[model samples]
Target: MIKVAFFDAKSYDEVSFNKTNADYGFDIRYYQEHLNLKTVPLAKGADVVCIFVNAECNAAVIDELIKNGVKLIALRCAGFNNVDLKAAKGRIKVVRVPAYSPHAVAEYAVSLMLALNRKIFRAVNRTREGNFALKGLMGFDMYGKTAGIVGMGRIAKELIKILHGFGMKVLAYDLYPDMEFAKQYDVQMVSLDELYAESDIISLHCPLTPETTFLINAQSIAKMKPGVMIINTGRGKLINTEELIEGLRTKRVGSAGLDVYEEEKNYFYEDRSDKIIDDDVLARLLMMPNVVLTSHQAFFTVEAMHNIALTTLESIKEFGEGKPLTNEVVEQ
Candidate 1:
């Protein structure tokens, strides 16, 4: 019997994984705490250890897993930046659920854009307080506006379709351009500079790599058109939070929506409503009415969760059977 230990197991995770495990019959152990060096011993008797996005799988944690006789690290989410692939190389195989539900995240990104543009968040707050005046609820029409998408991945493609429904011109940038898709969607593939200068709304759908980290800093923000709305459903580190605060301070950025943050590991999945947020930049973003922040919930739908659990267990079963690991992440 193959044993798998899951870290950062929330109620939803347990329910989904247990339901899916009925088919696999794997001995799965659940731990509420995230996997770090401190909690490494919990995987002592497991052959495979599964982790979520925020779990710490640094060199130290990887070393402990090897010592514990663990053979594989299965990531439940698509993004694997949290796992140190370099350290796990040649020691333990790392696999992930690459595309559980691109539509879930893409739809959430659109929801953020709609909420910000229509002032839905503020309007809901005002109605609860018995203030139904439309004095400051003015919003511009989305039709005929230009929307710039930073990446041309699966999620971005889903968003492009929705943006087309709104009659918005789509401008996209990707290192490896998919000209066929661009032609199909009638999207203009432009340089990053052109996308920044011409777009009415800029949305990020890229991954967080060494080259793409802090991609939307002060220098990039300066190139953007004044009053350009910015939206990020990508990795948190894609935008420098401090620089974003400065952009919001001035009127340079008309409105902003984010589902991720650079330093979100400390506060995103956990509840800290009773405690004060020590992160100054995050606190400042919360104070801005134009800014809307979600706690990394772009991939939180029931379908996505079910797909994640099914795919994750399937990969583990593949590894157990000595089959080809399709979603394996090698050292880059």
Candidate 2:
């Protein structure tokens, strides 16, 4: 049996994998501790080390894994930005579930947009307290508004379809433009500046690359239409949190929906309600009524979780059998 040291093991993860692993029958050990330098020793004799977005798979950690006889690094989440692929090269194999469900994330982005625009969170709180005054519950119609999408990936494509259904003119920007898909969907492929100036709402779905980090900084926000709504369900560092707060302060950004933060790895998955947030930027963001911060749960749907478990386990099984790993993450 292939031993898998599953790190950052949440109860939901265990539930999903345990049910799916019945068919694969791999020896699985679950640990709530994240995969880091200190926790890497737990995988001393394991054949595979399972990790999530929060796992610290830096070069040093990779070296430790190699010393411990670990051969494979299995990432359960879609984003591998946290992992050092350059360091993992030519050493241990790395594989990820390229996509579990695009709809789940896209739908959550839409929900954020709706909640912010309609002041749904505020209204719910007021009504629950029996203060049902409509003084600040005004919302504009989504119809006839222009929505700009940062990346035309799977989640962006799904979001575009939904936005178009609501009579929103979609403007998309991608490093690589899929002209065929754009033409089919009647989406206008525009330059970043054009999208920023023309869009009433801008949503990010891009990957976190060196070039894309802090993509939404002060300079970019300055080019956007005044009071433009920004929604980010993508990687946290995609937007500079300090700059976003400044934009909100000056009314440059009307509202923002954030499911991830740049420093989210510290406090996103873990419960810190009892303890005050030590990060000043994150705490300031929390104080903003315009901002709706979620705990990186855009991909929490049951269907998505099931697919993630099945796909991750299947990749491990293939690695064990020496089969071609279609989902393997090789150095590009």
**Per-residue lDDT tens digits of candidate 2, residues 1-332?**
99999999999999999999999999999998999999999999999999999899999999999999999999998889888999999888999988899999999999999999999999999999999899989989999999999999999999998998999999999989899989888899999999999999999999998999999999999999999999999999999999999999999999999999998888978888899788999989989999999999999999999999999999999999999887998877
Estimate candidate 1's alpha-carbon lDDT, on a 0 to 1 scale. Answer: 0.93
Q: For residues 68-158, could you state the per-residue lDDT of candidate 1 as single tens digits?
A: 9999999998899989998988889999998999999989999998999999999999999999999888888999999999999999999
Which of the numbered candidates is closest to the native, going by highest lDDT?
Answer: 2
List clash counts for every candidate, in order: 0, 0
What does each candidate score in C-alpha RMSD?
0.8, 0.8
